[model samples]
Target: MIGAGSTVIFHFDIKLSDGSAAESTRVHNKPAKLQMGDGSLSPAFEAELSGMQAGDKKTFTLEPQDAYGMPNPDNIYYVDRSKFSLDAPAQVGMIIGFAMPDGSELPGLVREVVGDSVTIDFNHPLAGQTLTFNVEIVQVIN
Candidate 1:
């Protein structure tokens, strides 16, 4: 059986609130190994995995706050249309990666395009919605 601080290997499928698959470790055939209660996952998300034995399969849902937190309106920003290259076409639902001041890339979705401005939402697409995860514990490695 798995307990807190145990290192375990597992495969999981994450689905969006709309029932769309967001990611799956099984697709790549790679099982993930992690220590329980090790800050590798959100507290709420990890709580569901506690006290499970190897070969156990479970499915659970997590609310936004417990997953990625709610989307904030302040994350929406408008950029001048001219900032984009004239050859680059802007469209709704397009994900644009922006370089932060720290040199890290942050992805933002194009929400709308106006005459001279483009609205971008920096919030995570999964924000403000519940997520479902289908997980199978493949092995318990101490």
Candidate 2:
């Protein structure tokens, strides 16, 4: 059984609330490994994975807040078109990385591009959405 110290490997298929596929490790024929008691996954995710054994299959759903949290208004920003480099023009649906004051890069998607302004959304692409996870436990090592 999977417990706090167990290392479990599993294959997962993720779907959005709209019934569209988000991701699936089965397509790559690779199983994901996770060590319990570590902070690799969210608390809710860990809770859901606990107490399962190898070869077990389950489908669970996570709410927006429990999954990626709700979208923050502060994450949306509008920048002038001139802020982008001429060689790298900003276009709608583009994912661009902007350097922060701490020298770390934050990725933002171009939501809209007007004549002189570009609206970028820093919220995670999955934010504010319900998620379904279909998981198959392949192995467990204590």
Candidate 3:
């Protein structure tokens, strides 16, 4: 069983409320290793792993607040079309990566493609929706 300070390797799949698979370690053919209580995983998500033994398979769902938090309307913004290259096509539902002031790359979804303006939302697509996780405990080291 796993406890505080234990090193563990597990495979997990995250799915959105609509049954779309958002991410999966199994798909990559790798397992994630992490130390318990190390701040790598959210406290709420980690709490679900407590007391789980090796070889255990579990599935659970979490609300938006417990997962990635609800989406904020303020995250949506309009950008001037001139900022994009004229050769680049602008279309709704496209995900564009933008560099942040901190040098981090943030992805924004294009919601509207007007004549000279584009509406983008920086919030995670999964935000504001319940998520389901399927996890399999592959290893546990104390």
lDDT for every model? 0.90, 0.92, 0.91
Q: Given candidate 3, what's the lDDT at residue 90?
A: 71
> Per-prediction RMSD in angstroms?
2.4, 2.4, 2.2
For model 1, residues 55-107, the per-residue Cα lDDT tens digits are: 99999999998887899999999999889997887789999999999999999
Tens digits of per-residue lDDT, candidate 2, 13-72, equal 989998899989999899999898797777788788899999899999999887878999
Best by lDDT: 2
lDDT of 1: 0.90
Record all residue pairs in model 2 with backbone atoms less than 3 Å apart, i.e. clashing. Answer: none
Listed in order, each prediction's TM-score against the native is: 0.80, 0.82, 0.83
Ranking by lDDT: 2, 3, 1
lDDT of 2 at 25: 95
lDDT of 3 by residue, 1-142 (tens): 8899999899999998889999999887899999999987767788899999899999999888878889999999999988888687778998999999999999999999889999999998888989999999999999
**Per-residue lDDT value at 132 in model 1:** 98
TM-score of candidate 2 versus the correct structure, residues matched by position: 0.82
- Identify the superior model by lDDT, candidate 2 or candidate 3: 2
Clashing pairs in 3: none
